[model samples]
Structures are given as C-alpha cells and as structure tokens.
Target chain A: MTEGVALLTVFVLAVFVGFEVVSKVSSTLHTPLMSGANAIHGVILVGAVIVAGTADEAGVLVVALIAVVLATLNLVGGFVVTDRMLEMFGARRPEAAAKDGAE
Target chain B: MIAVWAQVCYVVAAVCFILALKGLSSPKTARRGNLVGAFGALLAVVVTFIAYDIDNLGWILLAVAFGAVGGAMGARRVAMTAMPQLVALFNGVGGGAAALVALLELSEPARAGITRPAGFGDDGWFAYSPLAESGGHTESEILRMVDLLSTGTLTATAFTVLIGAVSFSGSTVTFLKLQELMTGRPITFPGGPIVFGAVLVAAVGLGLWAVATGSVTLAIILALVGLLAGVLLVLPVGGADVPIVISLLNAFTGLAVAAGGYVLENALLLVAGTLVGASGTILTRAMAHAMGRSVSSILFGAFKGGSTAGGGEASDRPVRSAGPDDVAIMLAYARKVIVVPGYGLAVAQAQHTIRELVDLLEKRGVEVGYAIHPVAGRMPGHMNVLLAEANIPYEQLLEMDTANGQLRTADVALVVGANDVVNPAARTSPGSPIYGMPILDADHAGAIVFLKRSMRPGFAGIENELLFDPKTTLLFGDAKASLTALVSALKSL
Candidate 1:
C-alpha cells in the first residue's frame, strides 16, 4: 500500500550494492568485517523503539522492551568487540615496528 | 509517515554502514571505518527517539542503558581465545531481538491504525484488544484496512520471524560448540535427516499459511519450528567447521533483519540488512573454500559419515621424538623458518611464547614468517588477533598462499600446537576427509618439528600422514612449555 513497488526497487538495488561492497575483501579482515556488519543490523533497535513507543498493552510493552535490550547488546557489544579487534590491528603497528627497530 | 529530515538522516546512517563495511575489508582504513559506522548507529538511534512520540520513554532508556553496560563489559573483558564465542553470542542476541520485535508487531495489528473485525484475533492469534478502536466504520474502511494488510507485508513478516528465530538458535549452538561447553564433534540421531527435512518443510508451509490467512498462531508455530531447524542445522557440523556455520548464521540474521525492515517500511533497515546479508553470504563461502569444503557438505557431512569420522586414537607409529634443545638447535641453525600456528596454540595461550621464539629466531638471523591458514584458529583472522595481542609484527604474518611458496625454500617448519593446517593428508589422500583443502606446504621444508601434547588427531579427528615422515621430528609437551624451552635453548646457543 505504501508504494511497495518503490520498496522492492530499493531492496533489489541494495542487494547488488551489498554484494559489490564486500566482494574483494581479503580473508584477514573476515572476522572484523562480520562483526561490524553484525553491529550494523543492531539498527533493528529502531524497530524495537518504534514498537515500544506505541504499545498500549503491558504484555506487548514488556516484550518490546526485552527486544530493545537484546538489540542494544547486539549493537553495542558488536561494535565494541569489533573495535577491540581492529584496535589490536591498529595499536600494535608502531609498537611492533619499534620492537623491530630496537632489535 | 517519516519526516523529511528523519528520512534524510536514515539515509545518511545507511550510507555510513556501507562505507563501514567497505572500509572494514582493507587493513588501512579499517579502524576509522568502524568508528564511522558507530557514529552512524548512534545517529540513527538518536533520530528514532526524537522522530517518534514513543511512550514508556523512561523504561526504554533504562533498558538501553542496562544492555549497553552489559554489552560493552562483555566485549571488553572477553579473552582473545574466546573471541569467536563472544561474536556468536552477540549475533544470537541480535537475531533473537529481531524475531521478538516481529512477534510483537504481529500481536499489535491495530497499531497500524486500522479497525479490526469483532471476531478478529479470536482464532488462536494473540487475543489482544486493539490499541485505538474507532466506532462503527463503513465497508470501504474495512476494505482499506485489508489493502493496508497487503500479502506482501505479511509475507515479509513471516519471513522475518522464521529466519530470525533460526539465526538466533543456530548462533547460540555455535557459541556453545566454540566455548567447548558442548561436544565439538557432530551429534546425529537415527532418522535425523528425515526429521530435519520434515520440520523444514513444515516451517515453510506454516510460513505460507501465515501469509495467506494472517494467522498469528501459524507464525508463532513457525518461529518455534525455525528455532528447532536452526539447532538441527548446526548440530551435525564438527568443531573445526563451526566458524563457517557462524558466518552462515550471520547472513541468515541479516536477511531476517532485511525482511523485518520491509515489514516496518524502513529504508535504513532494509539497506543495512541487505548489505550484511549479501556480504555475509560471500564471506561464508570464502571461509568454507578456505577449509576446502562446501557449505552443504560441512552441515550434512557427518550424516553422510564421510568428513568427520576418524579414529581419535593416538598413533603408536614410531615418530622420531626430540628434546626441546634438539629442536632449538635445529631452529637456531636454520637459515629460514616458517611457523604454522593453530587452535592448540590459542588453547594453551602460547601465542606470546611463540612470538618470543620467533623474535629470537629472527635475531639469530633465521628468517621467520608465520604461515597463517585462512581458518587458522577457531575463526578466520583469529590467529592474527592472538599474535597481534602478543606484539607480533603484522609483517611477519603471511597468508596461506604466500607462506606455502616460502615453505619450499625454508630450512625448518616449526609447527607449534598446530596439526591439520600443515597436514599433508589434505593433498595426498583423496579418501581423506580434508583431501581437497589447500594446506600449508609444511612438508616442503627440509625439516619439520611438531610440538604436541599428545598424538591425538586434529579437530577433524583425522590423522596427519606427514607425522610419519622421517624428516618430521616430534617434541612432546604443552605448546607454551615447549616454546619456552625452545626460547631458552636458543638463547643458550
């Protein structure tokens, strides 16, 4: 009803964009990339918020709130962990170089 | 309808996610790219709270805070060895959340601002009172509501719930397997495939029924069955292959979120979810290829009784055993060395010790590089993280192909706490489980020294034929202890 055709167009285009973006990644970045993408879907938090905001029943509200908690974990935990992993990749470079230089 | 400004904001957030993924692929911009994605996630969350007249604002904020603190703590505190488990757990919760949101949306149909029929929801659906009921409306109004509840949206909702539930349970099982809380070996039952197929067909059938009739009961049943299907899907996969399963489930969760986006009519969710779904699929395929297996074979291989069956018994074949000093002397005199690190190294927490030994080898003018198999530890890129934690230079880490080429000219292949990656069985024996897998050419080296706790076969339970090679020397001990001895032994030299 709400321009389903338009949404379908968006979906189709997004699929191609998705495939194109990550098509050339090296295997070394696979773990962090997976984790980062996992965090991005945590945007489902938006859906949880919208539903929780409108729920008039206690049962629905409780369930929506639980959804919020879980999505928050997925979102926040995913980013933090991914960042932590990338930090290892970033933080050690100079130190490693320094160690090499010292040796 | 979303406001123009909010729509623009969502678009911006979605673009950020794309850039984040692109940046994450390469090493140079990866950290900065993650930060950009985080900023976008923060922006989208803030915009949602502002754009919607959300009730229970205080409670929702509290829940957000509670989850944030817990997630950050867990992410920060987990050991590097358990990174795969943590990722699996976080992925599970995300998937579970998507399913629950879709379920809640199904229960509150009138929130879409349509009048429900009097007997509506009485037929085994969630029997909840409509949130905003308008007085007696015309037949046209009813028809309008029907138009709003298009088959398209309903179908998307059904897809969301089923796939989300599957991703949730599958990720949890993967986490358990990775954490060693459950047996890493494949678990199969009599008529397992038949039951799995039946339940899968039932889930798809129920999903179509839910879409056709808009029955919440059918949807709920579909979710339960989907959860069962997820568990059954991953149960037969052996431990070494669980990472691929996790990647596959990550893709599943992404597609579920994409469907949920369609149901909610949100462009940002649609785009972000689609990106993950697509990218995760490719990533899963790449990981499987790295292990020399197909996705289907990894899942159902145990049932076929081919890939995972092997004797766990330690081989009594006489392998030339050596002391740490002998191995150290071998390493100290070598002109070049390649170290093959694996899950055992991570398990024994010997990465730092190995790094120390590598450094000492380099100081002795012995060229050293780590031959990193794609699925090296529990997950792709796992050993890099572990070795990086130990301050090992990134330059010293070589991809499997590069390491293989170097192995031919190397004097010694010092395999520490690794078995399968260097196992020549992947190449020589067609009947072997890992026959087609691309293994590190450790056997190409002039001499091979293996550090082992025992003669136990690798995670696939397959024996390594290279162990019987006369050029191979076994130094029996814990990886850390053996590495420490080698480090000191080299120092004495």
Candidate 2:
C-alpha cells in the first residue's frame, strides 16, 4: 500500500506535466497529435502481457490475450497513422514557390 | 538487480513519452517525437517481457503478431479522409483493452479457487520482489493482499471498467458517423436530454453498486450500462460536432487507462495514462470552445436542428447559379483566391483536384491560399492533412481569423463543398445554433464561387446565410467534376 501512495504522487505530477506539454500544439496538427497521445496509452499493453501469458486459468488467459491484441492494435495503429500524417507536413512545400503571394 | 534494470527502463520510457508530446507542439519535430514514443513503447514491452513471470508465451506472441500485421495493413490501406475513423476505432480498441484487463484481473481468482486473497494474479497486486520469499506465510503479506481486494482497489476496478466501456462504445459510434456507415445527423430521441440524464444517473448508481458489493457481475452490468451511456453521448452530436465528440472520447480512453494503471499498481502506466488523459481533456475543451460551445453543451445539446422547413426557406432565398465557363472566367481573372475546404471536399474526394485548380490559378498569375477553420472537416486539422497529402505548402493554409481578415482584399473565395464555416448566420441571427461560432468571412470577397451538390445546409443543419449574399454565385454539381471542368475551361482560353 505504501507503493500506492508513490503511484498517486506520480499520477498527480503527470496530470500537470502532460497538459503543459501539449497545450500549444498548432490547430492544423491536432489530429496527428491526438493520435500520438492515443499510442502512449498503449502502455497498458504491459499489464495485458503479464496477465495473458501467466494467469492461472485458461479463461483469464484467453480474455487477457484479447486485451493484449487490442492494446497492440491501438499502440501500433496509433503510432503508424500519426507518423504517416506527420510525414505529409514534411514535404518541403514545393520549393516555397509562393510566400504570402496572395498579399 | 533485474528489478533495478526494469525500473530504469520504465523511467526512460516515461521521459521519452513526455518528450514526444512536447515535440508535437510544432510540425518541425512531430515525426521525430512520434518515433521517440515508438522507441519508448518498444523498450517498455521488452523490459516487461524480461520482468514478467510466464508459464506460457505462445498465446502472447501470437496476439502481438496478429496486432502488428493488422495495424500496418490498416494504416497503409486507409485513405486520408478515413484517418479520423481509424483513430476513433483505435481509441475504442485501447478502451476495450483497459476494461478487459481489469475484468480479467478480478475474475482470475474465482476460477483458481483462491478464496481469501481474491486476486492471486500472475504477479499478484504487488510486484513480485525478493522480500516476498518462497513461503507465503507472513501476516503482513496476507493483510496487504486482503487490502488490495477489499477496499480501494475494488473502487478503482469499477471506475476503470465503466470509463473504458464508455470510451469503447462511444468511440465506435464516432467511427460509424465518420465512416458515413451511420448518418452524421444528430439522432436524438424525444426528450433526448432527459433520457441521457437518466442513463447517466443509472450508470453512476451501477458503478457504486459494483464498488459496494465488489461483485464482478455488478461490474460487468455496470460496463454494459456504461456502453449504453457512450452510445447516448455521441448519438445526438451532429457531423460538425463529431470532431469534439471524438476528442472527448479520446480523453475518456485516457482516463480509463489511468484507472487501469491503478488496478495494476504500475507507475509507468500511471504516468503515461495520466499524460494522455490530460492532453485529450485539454484538446477536447479547446475544440468545444472553437465551436462556441461548452463541453457539456456539445455533449447534451442534441444540436436540435431547426425544424423550420429547410426547403421552404431555401426556395425563398434568391441565388445566382453559374456554369463551369462562368466560374472559370471569374477565377481566371481574379487577383487572389481563397479556397475553403470542408467535410464536403473530403466527401467528394476533391482535395487533389482542388489543388490542381489552385496550381492552374497560380500559373495564370492569380495568387491562391486556403482558409482553414479550426473545426473544419470531420476532425480537427482534417483539411490540413488532406491538402498536405496533395503536396500543398503549409504556409498557404491560413487560420480562420487570419483568412477572414484578408477576405475583403481577396478577389475570389472559392468554396468547395463547405457551408457551415462560411455561413454568415454565425455572425448574425442569434436564434441560429451556430450564431456565436466563428466563421470564415467569405462573403467579404469581391466575388464568391461556391461548389456544391445542392443547396443543402452544412452538417450543423443550419442554412448558410452567405449563400444569399449578392456577391456569391452558386455552381451546382460534384466538387471534383466542377473543378476539373473549370480547369479545362481555363486551359481553353
């Protein structure tokens, strides 16, 4: 239970740190940023791993295996999609042919 | 010694995740930030494998293999327009995983006949340590295991399961709407608000019951009730409002992950999950604000589309319609043009064709730029991704406030399949649902050319007051075909 107190402290600090980190993301990149954040929550895949591989009963293992599969999908899909979207923003804008040409 | 190594790896992973988000604040470092997060994810999995005790590895390995293949295939196959839908589905998957992990943790003991301690899971509630020893006879160990089941842990299990259930089903509804497999129109029932209110209360009651009784059955029932509540949450939000709903549900998945971390007593999970939860919440509020609404209003407003006969009002409104040649002449001679992209553009799959038109206009010495509303398309930043895929420069994509200010000076504002953001009703007509929402000042352009399938109201189901302005000329037909025709017309001249 002493570890629970430590976990609580870590959780509380993360709440503030996390918000501060992403508060200034440009509106254009919001979707990819969100998808990136989605991948981060896949950290729970670790819990799924332990439960699926070593739980005493077949039922628990089966359910945990499903959880494992889902977490993997979310984790991998989230990062890949985010990377693909961000890749579009990196194309160097066709030699910067028009710099506020509309003005 | 191995414990120390695993803890160190976990710490590094947490830092990488923090850095990943911090870098995502700008486009310059976003990709690198993502790779860093991936590295962290891979490292976390490796470290866990080292630390986790396993009697069997075949099932876990198979699951990982299955996910990797499915994820890669989906990412490559999905069109840019469907990215939001894919993201929604991923959020649902993560939420489902969290809920299942909590449920399996609770159910394991009943099957194994562990009566006193309740959860004799793989590593038990506490991380297996050297102090645990071979003999499980210590009074303190017994008390600690009992405490894990009896009080605080049971509450966390209930919270995680319910939040996870809501995120899973709520995200699925958002996905369906984005995919157009279900109607994007708000599907509110009679007394919709009151119905949702009752469901919310019932869900809360169920959550408390699960905690009070520590009954797995109650928790499962509570999860089902939560699933119903999720569907109710997103069903009433119209297409224009679905972006915010997706963001809100993304936040819900984050909160559920954090709750799951508590149940597992894992600090890395605690940090990563809380960070995601906080980020999603902040983004959700920002999205809601951009719509000139509160989070609660967006969730419960039902959008309640105006019943004032859409056909009757549109019939009385006088609009000058034009052919491709007339639109081509207007666009060709304009000094500057602002192309406003919307959900319609995505639906028509006209992003590339519109980019071609912009290029033609550019070659003809007409300056071209895009006016991007914050809440454009199906999700936030949707237009930017679509245009970028067509290799449009990031510089030409102007924010709504900036573009609106420049609209007066621009000669032509070519609106392709967009309606709500350009609607003047947002600035006038207090009775309008989108009255206070910010809109692109397309009407201020010297001439306005609108591309549309028909005179249909935008997803908000509100009439575009801009369409009635004398400077606007409505061009009827598919967005891509109209633009392609306009390109040919310009080439002929």
Interface RMSD of each: 2.2, 3.0
Model 2 alpha-carbon drift over 4 Å, by segment: A92-103, B114-147, B305-317
Worst 10 residues of 2 chain B by lDDT: B113-122
TM-score, structure 2 vs. true: 0.92
Give the root-mean-square deviation of each candidate in angstroms. 4.1, 4.8
Which docking band does candidate 1 fall into? Answer: medium
Error of 2 at B330 (Å): 0.9
Give one digit per residue, the lDDT tens place, for model 2 in B53-111. 65568779899889978987898789888898899999999999999988876664334
lDDT, candidate 2, at B184: 79
TM-score of chain A of each: 0.87, 0.84
